[model samples]
Target: MEQESFRERRQAQAMGIDLPLGNSPADIRRRMEAIEFLLERSIQIPGTKYAIGLDAVIGLLPVVGDLIAAAMGSFIIWEAKRLGLPRWKLWRMVGNIALDTTLGAVPLAGDAFDLLFRSNSRNLRIVKRHLDKHHPETQIIEG
Candidate 1:
């Protein structure tokens, strides 16, 4: 399946090596596009124009909100680690989330920072590109 293979390509890219992966730049593009929808509001989800976004949905939890958000954001670092990203860079990535989580505790101000920072989505993209480069064998499989 393409979904499983996506990780493969991502892994390949992170290593700075070439693999037998085929092309489906669309998948990559789609992911980036999805981040927009995921990280922010885009015309709203129809019935919920004023619906809570990652920033708002996440903000409502107060202290718990930032903790959960930061934890979820840590997935990027986890993914990077899976792709064997350099330790220094990986640490820096974690630091980004830490910073975001810390600063995102200012109530309304923190939510604003979440929207502006969007570090989780940004880091995911960065790691994906890095992984894709080394392991281009992201052949979409169908069953």
Candidate 2:
């Protein structure tokens, strides 16, 4: 059975089909967590309870900053696409990034927006929902 499965996977790969192998739910979750940390809350504000990440720090660089942050945010979208999320869901994720970038371009306001928006985290949630609904094996059931 294993040999047949391996043979079929190889055939699929040879045919240019991207198959999800060994990408268990745990792996996806860990990826999401890392992305969230990078884009959302990797640093804590001194003498304050608020947290921030690279996304906000990068967004502080004027025009180029928001662009860089948007580019980083696209990573989550790319992962969602790899997971075979529906078009609408993908669009929604794009919208989140778009909104984050658009509003994040507004100098002071944009930096604040980046601090609060956390588009990567939102995209991660969308990916998780899609995985739970479409890929049962990737779902992490809680007691």
Q: Candidate 1 residues 6-90, lDDT tens each?
A: 8876775575322334334434433433433444443355675443346446755787988877776665576567667788778
Residue clash pairs of candidate 2: none
For every model shown, what is its TM-score relative to the native structure?
Answer: 0.59, 0.76
Please, what is the whole-model Cα lDDT of each candidate in the order they appear?
Answer: 0.62, 0.80
Instruction: Work out candidate 1's RMSD over C-alphas.
Output: 9.7
In model 1, how large is the Cα lDDT of residue 139?
Answer: 31
Cα shift from native, residue 16, model 1 (Å)? 31
lDDT of 1: 0.62
By summed lDDT, the worst window of 10 consecutive residues in model 1 runs over 17-26
Model 2: lDDT equals 0.80
Q: Kindly list the per-residue Cα lDDT of model 2 for residues 1-143, writing each as its tens digit.
A: 88987887687567444343456665655566666776788788999998898899999999898898888888778777777788999999999989998899898988877888888888888888777777767676679
